[model samples]
Target: MKTLVVYYSLEGNTKEAAEKIASSIGSDIMELVPVKDIPKKGLMKFIHGGSGATMGKGTELQPYTKDASSYDAIVIGTPVWAGKPCTALNQFLSDLSSTEKVIGAFAFAGGSADKCLSFLREKYPSIKYTVSLADRNSKKLAPENGSKLSAFIEELKSELISN
Candidate 1:
């Protein structure tokens, strides 16, 4: 199956996990870039980025050539903001709606992924698999949280083969 790993990263944590998943699954990758970059430091960053996600605001992304629907399966990754996915990732998911494609998601957060999972499940109920990671434990890609990502990739591969 042709799979794509799409993600948005404010810091490098989400990007690292995405890279590991892409490499493990041997899938193409796409990075979402917001037209206006979010601030990395200070309370304003939290107020703007966190509230944007909380309010379900979408950001303008740079021109991306790959279409998510073209892939047979898709894996989405993002850093959690205010217990939700980042604004840029939310925009990506908002623009992407495909019933024919198999979907999976992974969220990295400084705290927890409960709210992130809740949001994802509510928005994309068809997602077959999902995982959450803490940034402190996800410093390197190969084996984060007892190789959960690798395991997830293997499961996805199995599902693809079975289908």
Candidate 2:
């Protein structure tokens, strides 16, 4: 199956995880970039991002070449903000053109991602798999989270085979 990993990252944690997953599964990857991004540093980052996430706002994204409908499966990744997905990721999900393909997601958070993951599942009912990773604000992969990611990749592989 042709799988694509789509994600948006503000602090690189989600990017690192997305890269690892794409490399492990040998799938294509696409990064979602917002046209107008929130401040990356300072108190305003929290204020703006948290408010947007709390309101479930979706931002405008830069033009992307990948057509999600062409893939058999899609694995989305995002950083959890205010217990919800980041604005860029929300935009990507909202713009997704296909619903028949298998879907999966991964979330990065400072603490537990239970709420974010649940929110994703509820909003996107087609998602068949999910994994959460601790956002340590570093490029280095955590050992425990690595294992969880591996398990997620395996499940995705199995799902692809079944389909």
Supply candidate 1's per-residue lDDT for 18: 88
**Tens digits of per-residue lDDT for model 1, 23-108:** 88789999999999788888888988999988878899998769888898888888888887888987887787774463788888
For model 1, the local distance difference test gives 0.81
lDDT of 2: 0.86
Per-model TM-score on C-alpha atoms? 0.89, 0.92
lDDT tens readout by residue for model 2, 38-140: 9999999999999999899999898986988889889999898999999988888778777546389999988877789999888788898999888775345
- Model 2, position 61, has a per-residue lDDT of 92
Off by over 4 Å in 2: 100-102, 137-143
Clash totals for all models, in order? 0, 0
